[model samples]
Target chain A: MNPPLSRRDVLRRLGFVAGMWWAARAEARDIPGDSVYQLRAQLTDQDGRSFELSSLRGQAVLVSMFYSSCEQVCPMIFETIRLTLLALPVADRERVRVMMISFDPARDSVAVLKATAEAHQCDARWALLRAEDAEVRRIAAVLGVQYRRLASGEFNHSSAIELLDTEGRIAARTGTLGAADPGFVKAVRKALSRQA
Target chain B: MALEIVRRATRIVVCAAAACGTAMAADFITVPGGRFASVLPQGPVPTVSVPVEVAAFAMRATPVTAGEFLAFVRAHPEWQRGRAPAIFADRRYLVDWRSPVLLADGGAADRPVINVSWFAARAYCESERARLPTWLEWEYTAAADETRRDARADPQWRRRILSWYERPATTSPPRVGGAPNVFGVSDLHGVVWEWVDDFNALFIAGDSRVQGDPDTAKFCGAGALSVIDRDSYAVLMRIALLSSLSAADTTGSLGFRCVRPGGERP
Candidate 1:
């Protein structure tokens, strides 16, 4: 019952099939051995755009975890990361991106995340993401960030800035907060330079 | 001679069938949860035993065996020794195996699978639609003995568990057939060190004294958690071992089992 295929029709069908194949291949490439991209967690950014953690590949990332309700150390975390980025050269800064994941995902919805992003003066280069409670725990485990929720609706957590290379490998980590550690900044610069 | 040959063939067929049955069935026992006092104190005080309210759940009757893990890897190649990503497992993962997918000659199929990273164990549990028990759940279930539900308060019970820890780590572990505890669960102690979901949360602080320093900024909220019941050496030893490990780190004697939510069948 099928019609005889013309050359134009045949080429059109072949192109469509090839396009689909390419798309699937690109989506399913093998992740690197040392990359944290292997973790499967769904995240929604401050802009309410949903994405996987693996989608941040191909760009060096400065990652950390914090909660919106945290008044003392959390704000310092944002400031500390901001200063760390400022320490880098302008060109290198443009090459490196930043991601802040919330450990208190139940309270930090997209609207709250958007407000926090604005308060921190976060530009497009930065992403404030929220995930479910279990996914948050998994992300914290992968990053070696420790946290525990208290009875008072507050959280006690270890603060660290992890530098992830383009492939999502943790190249360097520093627990020094409230100020930028020069050595960590240098590592970030080196990771960015390596990407180029 | 023909009769002897037939008998040998029959024995082989029976053994193969039994192995197949075990591979298909992983026994799980229901644990009725309740208000339990844990050796680890909640909040900052060390004087009171933190009352933890645990919900009912089902736990594997025994630690996952080498045969089960091998079959799991065969079904999901991504978790095999060399094939798994380094971020999820260290180089020592399944190093004792004969190859990436095969067990060595002396590695018994029923022995608890060891040298597995937490991530690998978690993935295996996820494949079964289950998960590693939280530290509280494991601690609560482990507090029981064959006759009594809360045998942890008995000195003899504590001594028995501590004796297992005193044994040299170099010795080969026995098979996963330890006597069942009060909950009808086996191998909760005296077998292998199992991974809990919240191992990192156990010892987030290196020491309680460090909380006063500016470096304490590393930890938010109520600084580092201090020990409540310092006399529970067996539980403390477990916490120390777990605290020293990263998720990707594996050990020669470390293994894990899965737990399902209450009333869920597996």
Candidate 2:
């Protein structure tokens, strides 16, 4: 006859299984995409001030799509962005700003965005913004962003980042998850050269 | 639209086993040629040799005049606006998608259709199973110089070429005699910037060894293999030129010429 394990022992075993399950399911399905939306909508930040994306006439912007609650890719997305920003000499970094907007506007509040930014120790050059679902959809369509919902309150989405020059014209766009890819760096570098 | 003359030549493909022996002994009207030494190949190139060996193809001697592009519109009217090829609206194509120019050919039937993006040019070429020439091939076939004019040495030609820079964009291509390059290929240089299939392939400020990682010696721009004529005009020949324009850019200065595979023509 064998003795039963204690409550603490059962919880530890469950945690280990959950972690393994999460590990196995990393990099899951992709969101559907056909046409890219023509970027036109305006964006706002956690500070409550909004920047009309199309109106920011002469500033180069490095933009990505994300939500604060994401587990698999969003955090990794932030880290990737941080590294890319770090790679740029301070002069270039100051000239170019990074933007991340929450695709899941309903779930992510301004507070949530702030907390996420704080966790990453994000800088002034970077902004986390929130928007209405309809506006987000419009922006997404223009940027050709694709995202799908997950049962766990998260989402599966595309990893492309767009580079826009001072005139708000798209200088270059990379279909990569973040700044982690060398191709992303090269593309960004190329776009930066086109920047006025 | 009927103003310019393209000296339309029937497309001739000499390679087919059927045509090889019976092909006409074509006289390559080698006019006074120029020493575009830079245009010539150095060591070797990937797709084709450098100075471009355009075997010769049957092309409408004159460009598809403004009238030709116009008929394309009046017939398949639906294909005129939205259904038109993607390149027509490309920043490369100078044609305005919303308000296209009205030409004698309907709308630029004779006037070279400037402002055509590479995509638009490609779509036009593909609709008929043709394709745009590589830069080298286009230059080789069009450049005329039997009398041996050095493009750099001839002040008149040099000024004409530089006029493209710092000039307002216009749909009115240069007059036939005025725009032709040193080669007899009319409007090769100044009328409007022409489209090529491999649009993003090179950069004036770039190097060929771009596939590898960032080694200081590699992409660091130190002694980057100078493209043939690096000593002459700087930006016009720069590989990274396209990288400078907006993706939505379309100006009257842009146009295109076509090339076929194996340098053959139908």
Q: Please report the candidate that would top DockQ against the real structure.
A: 1
Name the candidate that leads on TM-score. Answer: 1
TM-scores for all candidates: the values are 0.89, 0.43
Q: CA lDDT, every prediction?
A: 0.85, 0.51
Stretches of candidate 1 exceeding 4 Å from the true structure: A1-9, A12-30, B1-23, B44-48, B204-215
Interface DockQ of each model: 0.59, 0.02
Write model 2 residue lDDT over A135-184, tens digit each, in one string.
Answer: 67445544545544433455546656777665445567765444456665
Residue pair clashes in candidate 1? none
Chain B in candidate 2 has what TM-score? 0.58
Interface RMSD for every prediction, one decimal? Answer: 1.5, 16.4
Span of ten consecutive residues with least summed lDDT in model 2 chain B: B215-224
lDDT by residue for model 1 (B199-258), tens: 877763456565455255777766666666677888888888988888989998899999
Compute the lDDT of residue B178 as modeled in candidate 2.
Answer: 43
